[model samples]
Target: MTNKKDENKLIAERRSKLDLMREGGNAYPNDFRRDSLSGQLHQTFDAYKDETLREEHIRVAVSGRMMVKRLMGKASFIKLQDQSGQIQVRVERDSLPEGIYQRFKKWDVGDIVAAQGELFRTQTGELTILADEIRLLTKSLRPLPEKWHGLSDQEMRYRQRYVDLIINESSRNVFQKRSQIVTYMRSFLEAADFLEVETPMLQTTPGGANARPFKSHHNALDMELYLRIAPELNLKRLIVGGFDRVYEINRNFRNEGVSTQHNPEFTMMEAYRTYAEYTDWMDMTETMLHGMVDALNGSTLVSYQGEEFDFGKKFMRMTVEEAIEAYNPEFDMARIRDREYLADYCVKIGVNVQDNYGAGKLQIEIFDATGEAELREPTFITQYPTEVSPLSRKNDDDPFTADRFEFFVAGREIANGFSELNDPEDQASRFRAQVENAKAGDDEAMSYDHDYIRALEYGMPPTAGIGIGIDRLVMLLTNSASIRDVLLFPHMRPESFD
Candidate 1:
């Protein structure tokens, strides 16, 4: 394909402008003083009528990219957009230097400019600034996306996030809300006596969760490390070290497939508290979510992807068996524990049942395939089978089930919590079982972490711990349909951007 020459011509023109700017003054000047945001100026003066605004002569200095421009013979109307929002600027020929006025006419829509002017109302009742002085702050080399069309291609949006953020109003709002959601969560945890902590992202063994990890090498120590799949194990060690309550909000890496809901790297909030059970975490989860939803939307009700969820209402609670039965009433309940029956059923259903896998694993597989999708409300599924919960304390009355609970909303897991396993001997045995699974070609199985077991020897308190995916939480709160929407720069295939 031949270059339309439009792009090249645009680039060449901007280069000429850059050279001209250097001759006249600095092409990229840093001395411009911006005393106000256009959004705030609008808010402060919007209430004033034309007569009041003109009488008060409210002078303000603002800086932003020129988003819209209409040049007349002796006057021009332009829209300048800053971090806050857009403001209109009206520049008369006599208001600025003759040379500067002529140069401003040639400036492109993407050019950064600073304007000092008096706030006034336009004939159409739109609030605007009558520019007394206008100076080019920075020259934009390339043009932005077409105004009416905007940036709508999803792949392009993720790959070139800066362009997406600049062109799309909703895109910027989503990220702004994402930051707020994280801030709200951190404050909530901090106020609850949870000390914010940081754990090593690089771990000798990724033991926290049964997820495949991305590995790296430490050259100095000649040791291999894995990007932590979850910070669970390290946070628990802090509990053993006498921290009563702790939380970490950071990144976790998993070697996994990408989807609307799945990313190789994601943010999460993991917290642990001493002397608390799985049930306590459940209550706290509900409370925190309720407050956050209110903070974001000013209500207990949250709407995501066309579904309404009542966060303030009491979350539904159920055992794994009860949840499975509720969602799949026709499923044979006896097959959940019948190892041979489940093994044959797994083969018939074309689901890979790992070799020597017990009925407990099969039970979860059944729930995942048939039941998990039906949990659309805030429901807590408790009493997870022991085989799938190595780091969780077993239920006192039932050896086969652990005191674990996963909160779900919109048919996806939102949070997971449990009473932690602290018995050194028991934990060692569980680790051994995982090692066996890993040996048998299960890459997602946890490793037998001797050091973590050694930490358990120091005796972690009766603790409740939970990890909530921050990306998904933002998705729900912002009504963002995909994980990529919340992430500013989601992973994308390498692309040519010229």
Candidate 2:
């Protein structure tokens, strides 16, 4: 979009400014230090009256980039912004050394500067810094975007995040809140005696989740590897190794299409606990979420994008069949269990269900088509079909369903967890089924990992594991509309300079 000619013209103008800056000793000086932030000044002095501030003579040294500037015949006003916030700076010909004010007049908006001044309120009641001395710390070569509507292009915003952070306070706040969310999650889990651990991102086999993997080759070893789609297997291996409880917050890679809810690479926090069941995990998850909401907002109720989600109340729990019945009473629960009936309904709803899919898998497709979008609040869809939940424990009373639960908020899955399938023989059988699924062109089906079966043979206790999409959680908590909005550098198609 930016043509070569216009780009060159701006470059030349900035270069001319750089020449003038070189005349000043050490144009990009780093030795300048600040005693306080702009936010600190406002916090400590915003309540003081103009006469009170002048009487107190609160001299403070601060440094930031020039965000706003208005020069008069002999005096000037500029807004200086730093990490914390922004404060106004007043400059007069008599305020600093005679030549310094003249030199400051030539400086541009994006230039970083250090100022030493006394705090006082302007006639309009703004907290201001009347500078006694000012110096440019770093000279910005390119001018900032236009004065008012700064960096509004969504694509440009993600591509150049530094500029986005500079112009948009809300954008910076989203990432800040994301950090808080992660911290709260980690702290809460640790408080409950869960150990945080690390797992390999690159693996010999992607056996954890049913997602397409990005494959790579290890040149040194002459072997193939995969960017792990999930850390489920490795984390469970830790469980077999005698660690009672563990959790990992890390990056996962999946060879998947880009969408509002998905990205190729994303963050997730997977946790496992020995001697725990799906019910135990569901309770812990709800308590942790409520604690997190309370910590961030002083309440457990959140308003996300105009929809009110009550995190304070207990979350709903229902079986997939129950949910389907609740959402669509017209569908016969008895007929839904029949393979042909479910398959026909799937086709009618435009959901592709292969013949390779068992009645359980077909039932899940029917549930997907009928019940998913009906969920508006926090709800746990439990009793997932065994065919689709390969690593989940099967119900003793009904082997057709696994003791699994997928947490949904605002109609999309945010977490998947279950009582882990620790029986070595059962796990092996499930892996073999997945292998057949893979052979049948289900690319997302997991590969067989004999090593995991061997680990299970050594005896893994009754363990529960859960994987929460950190990006999606951040999206919900921060009220971000898309996965891309939560992701600082979401993937995009290649761009051409021409």
Badly placed stretches (over 4 Å) of model 1 are: 1-7, 496-498
> Relative to the true structure, how large is the alpha-carbon lDDT of every model?
0.90, 0.89
Candidate 1 weakest lDDT stretch, 10 residues: 1-10
Estimate, for each residue in 333-360, the C-alpha lDDT of model 2 and write its tens digit: 8886788887777787799988699889
- Largest TM-score belongs to which candidate? 2
Which ten residues in a row are the worst by lDDT in model 2? 1-10
TM-score of 2: 0.97
For model 1, name the residue pairs that clash: none
